[model samples]
Target: MNMHKLVKVLAPAGIAATVVTSAHVASGDDGINTVEAAESTSSNYKYQGDTGYGDGNFLLNEALIKTLEEDGDLAFNGHTIEASEDDYETRADKKSEFVEEHDQKFTLRDGTATKVVFPIQDETLSIDDVTEAYGDDFETTESKNGKYETYVYKLGDKKDDDKKNIIAFKVEDGYVTQGTIGYSKSY
Candidate 1:
């Protein structure tokens, strides 16, 4: 090929690369666009991990949102499906995933047995904070076996009460840690 032809062929490639680069810059892949969009929006509030992948400042295939809403699971973190009444949110996750929203309608009560599970945190939680969440009457129990300590609570009063709540707290090294808080059919 002649030198002139070779130069012409490379010219188009150069222009294409510049165009792509400029497009990314204009769309805020750099710091400028992020600042612009965030300032114009909700005062740039920060979440734990907001990656700006869900921005709507530019035109996009918005039909993708509906498709994702109907079909997507919470495979990725922070992804959740809002409930119809907005009372709760469903977070589909793995075994070890930390879920933020779950509509646990059932409460623990008396003459009932409930199994509870929670992750142990650095600090120990007192029974007062735990008791506030459970409106029912309950008693903290210690087992003779070298096992977990339990707090038994009642959901309601009277023999006609159909539901009961029991909470067993898992303790480690003389400290109350984490445990499951759930309602059970068997007492």
Candidate 2:
């Protein structure tokens, strides 16, 4: 099959559609088929493989994104993504859209996730959740952006920290929306 057609067929699974197609083409049927190529690409959405959670149990990667997409009823770290039609919405930003529940949000860029927002929907997650999750190793800054009061966290509190991932929590009525986990983009 042609590269364009293959990529278009798999684009719904990833932003690296062309890359996946290229890999498939390069493999030349060496036990790698279209479905396997797509699945492998979906499982490897890269973000430096870091999740600022307990013991770093969860790494926010393509598997997480696929779970949130394929199975909408996923719960993690005291947050949940409800399975409802209204739970998903497309944003004006070309790179992103979001699937939100009453307390959690997942942001996708070109069908792969770049952010996951967790709110204080339960005792396990609160305004101090990120600090607790990342421990004293994180850096924080408070700011107000329009109607949103944000608390930003940088994973490692250092001047030359190599980690590009950051999390931000939105507060309203004195309650944290818990926080958003995302990575910086370079164009």
- Per lDDT, the best of the predicted structures is 2
lDDT of each: 0.30, 0.40
Per-residue accuracy of model 1 over 1-187 as CA lDDT, tens digit each = 2212322443565543222211111223453322111112111111112212222111111111222222212111223222121111111121222343221122212311122233434244444544544433655655577565666544323243223222344444544455443333322
Error of 2 at 97 (Å): 2.5
Error of 2 at 102 (Å): 6.6
Error of 1 at 158 (Å): 7.4
Local accuracy of candidate 2 as per-residue lDDT tens digits, 33-75: 2333443333232221112222221322223334333332233
TM-score, predicted candidate 2 vs. hidden true structure: 0.35
- Model 2, which residues run further than 4 Å from truth? 1-94, 101-103, 122-133, 145-151, 156-163, 170-176, 184-187
What is the TM-score of each predicted model, taking all chains together? 0.29, 0.35
How accurate locally is residue 163 in candidate 1, as Cα lDDT from 0 to 100? Answer: 31
